[model samples]
Target chain A: MRFRGRALKAYVVASLAVLALHYIVPYTVLHRAEGFTLYAFWSILAAAWVVATVVFVSWGWLER
Target chain B: MVRTIAEFLATLVIYIAVGTAIALVSRRFGVKTSSEYFVAGYRLGGFLSSMTYAATTYSAFMMIGLVGFAYATGVGALGFELAYLLATLALLTVLAPRVWLMARERGWVSPTEMLSDLYGTNALGHLVAVLYLVALIPYISAQMIGVGSIFEGLGAGFGTGIAVAAALSLTWVVVAGVWSVASTDAYQGLWMITAALTYVLWVTLFLVPSAGLDIGRVAEAITKAGVSGLGGFWTPTTFTAFTVPWLFFAVTNPQVVQRVFMPANERSLKRLIQYFAIYAIIYTLIVTLVGLTARALTEVGVLGYISNRDLVTPTLLLAAHPALASFIYVSIVAAAISTSNSIVLSVTSSFVRDLYERRAREVRPRRSITLANSVVASLVATSAVVAFLRPGFVVEMSVLSSVILLPLAPVTIAGWVSEGVRGVARYSSLVAVVVGVSTALYSAAAYGPKKAFITTWFGVPISVWVLALSTLIVVAGLLLSRVKPHVGR
Candidate 1:
């Protein structure tokens, strides 16, 4: 249950990256896409970020 | 219309029966102590924990509020909601493990207790409990409003709808505490997702084509709407002001924060996050698509014009097949009830555990359970009265609650990082809550409840000011403390 320094650093970086992409990606790359298309793409990216971070931070325990 | 009414009534009856049965069955799990009653003895499995978490987190706001928001505002609603999801994942990743470990090791029953234990101040716990009660009543009332509006849209008397919604919320939580709430939340969560998916599929495949609409053209129209400044509903200031409070929801809202202590083990907590992420993505996409399609239909004159964004879903349902419409209506009820019960339970737990028992100076589990049940009943009545008065929009009440809760973020984050330093002083926490809440209330009154981002201070939103000011007070208090730092608990 200890908060590992490595995991904490990774989590912070990943969170910032996700937040940045959440704003940047939609406003830039998908700004002109249809509402549904933009929503679908952004949701997929956000969901992937959640999964990736969970896996990365819990790697040791998840592996067990 | 008669057919719709019959379908609605029949579906409602069935939904109540099924939910009651689930609650009754969950009672078999037992609740001999206040902890078991309040938190299901912290033995919830991964699936139940995840389902309850999902159901409680996403409410009638999804179907009634968010759908309309998407239809009216364009893609900004999507970005705003996804921002919340992303922030939630980030917060839960860091906070949930620490919360879980602390709760398990300390046998903490309420979030207020955890804070009090962290800072070593009973007054701090009572202050937080009072803040929770004040902030959460509006939120619980919003759920009631959602239900009442949906029922009224279906031709029921508005008073009847409010009474029915309040009764449904009150029944299960009073019946078996978190046992009933969690189990029923799991059941209703499944129904909500299924109903949403069904409605989206039916709308896309059958309704749109029958109306002679082309999906490609609709997409083009929606995209054009975004490009023409219609999507500017989420201006930079507005977006940051609205989304920032919600992003910290997992840590700020006691209903969800308390769920951090419910998982039976570390593995269960991991699964809870994974399952909720998947459910949230699917639910958000389906709801958003439905909203966008409804907007396109209105543009083409196939659907009637919507004066109020909140009326969009009800109007859309009028065109749906009777059976489908009935199921979706029931799903909205399910969403409202699931969320309302969790809030009622969390608020009641805070009142009973943090205020009542803490003052009684002796632990009496049986009396505490009874007292909590009475508090739930009273709170439900108060919320029903507030909903009948119609204080504000569902989304507005939600955002206001989060704004009131914004100060808690810095305090909680400080608790985790300042392990070697003296914890926040009791007076400091109290002052921060008062200042944050008063500023938020003043802003709400001045700018109106529907406006989430009120730019009162040099173009910055009032919410950001509340956070910054509260953090300064708490940090200053800690640095100014002359007491020696206590070792880690």
Candidate 2:
């Protein structure tokens, strides 16, 4: 089966959470940080997104 | 580091010759049908699929536009570009499988055909095909302009640059259609990434330390420049305006959406997304660092402050090894040609499959392929002329095209997610596009494209408004039409 029921909800919630952190952290947490810190934070986020995507697809959550 | 025009032409000629040979050789693997010509008969493996997708998506915008943006905006440019990467990965993971399955089952050639099939209307396809022409021609012309700028920098006339770019784009597509384009795109994509790696290494290993600075000092310089954090032009509103349209690029952009139909199977499609995610992140960081590095150099008094952000990369090139710089320059040309040719091929698909085929009853496979080639040639020529003219609004029009295409997001999402987009929902797709495009055009005319893009409605950028309004229209149509919930593709 595809991402249905609990799996569907999980995917949506996780995506929304990551997205929220992406937007909110820049202003709330890193507002006064040096340029390098901010850059590292984003780089970490990018890496995490790549890992998550590979994991999700591997789990067959993205397929029908 | 100053190179003669003859030297520049020699590098470009060798690059073009190698690229042309790759494209020409690809014809042996080509099929004869229009579907084969346009989409490689939906048989691209993971490497070619991912490479073409990367090359087509990243354009001259990366090394030139984004580098400059990063120079001016600091870490915000990284955030903005990463937002796009993140969103694209999420969207592709969800939508690509469905689109690929459906296209394979139904033999859909054009992206418009898929939408038209889902919504049960040729009208939508025709309208979208026309919209593609209007929006993408300027974008294609912009790529040519990028090439012209690089050649002009090399002391070759801008006109010579544009003519060469136009000629290459036209020839590649005509040689074996998408087979040739994809083959050459894979080659160019390698060139692009290699150039990027060389550039980043040159900056970090040599340029920074030669200026009596290390990573720590560079960070200090950027921090002191006041571009390290979110303020100034990186204001929330401005970022929102800049990012919203780009976030939906996977769906709204025809060239990329068509790529969803190219990968040979489920595995290839998945690989395309995964590989592209890796490429996108790497390229994004490289360009962002290039910009920030330039800014850091300036702050430490090693280089002059470049007010025109676009010129930052060129200025930095002056200090680099001459051979390395010229390779990067050719890579920029490769980037432009790869992107422009893909656009030409895709727009031709829409023009032929959606518009022309509707009128010409029983267009034989050979005839349709011939017609497609003609359209590709015409598009290249027209874009070349537009690039030569160097219209003032070309850049604005290119940016505005994304905003104009915002309505496609809702229309496409609705078609894929719902069981059937029927009744008023079909009309809703049409209405949404018209309303969304008209609003964007009106704002561009009233406030000018640049200002209008950033113009906020209640602290929300106009781009967000365009998306919200388009979504609202689609939702209303769904409710009124009572489309059944989607079970699965």
Task: After superposing candidate 2 on the true structure, give the runs of residues whose Cα lies further than 4 Å from its correct spot.
Answer: A1-8, A61-64, B1-4, B487-489
DockQ of each: 0.45, 0.58
Question: How much TM-score does chain B earn in each model?
Answer: 0.94, 0.98
State every prediction's TM-score relative to the real structure. Answer: 0.93, 0.97
lDDT string for model 2 (B1-489, tens) is 346455667778889999999988998986688889988999999999999999999999899989999999888999999999888888888778777877888888888888899899889888888888888899999999999999888778799899999999999899999999999999999999999999999999999999999999999999999888887878888888988999899999999999989998777887898888888888999999989988999999999989888788899988876778888888999999999999999989988887766567787888888999899989999999999999988878987989989889989978888886789999999989898988888898999887888898788889998899989998999999999756344
The weakest ten consecutive residues by lDDT in model 2 chain B span B1-10
The alpha-carbon deviation from the true structure for residue B44 of candidate 1, after best TM-score superposition, in angstroms, is: 1.1
Question: What's the distance in Å from true for residue B352, model 1?
Answer: 1.0
What digit string (tens of lDDT, one per residue) describes model 1 on residues B150-177?
7777788788889999998999897789
- Model 1: C-alpha RMSD to truth? 2.8
Local error of candidate 1 at B166, Å?
Answer: 1.7
TM-score of chain A of each: 0.68, 0.79
Task: Flag regions of model 1 displaced more than 4 Å.
Answer: A2-5, A28-37, A57-64, B227-231, B391-399, B420-426, B478-489
lDDT of each: 0.80, 0.88
Interface RMSD of 2: 1.9
Model 2: colliding residue pairs: none
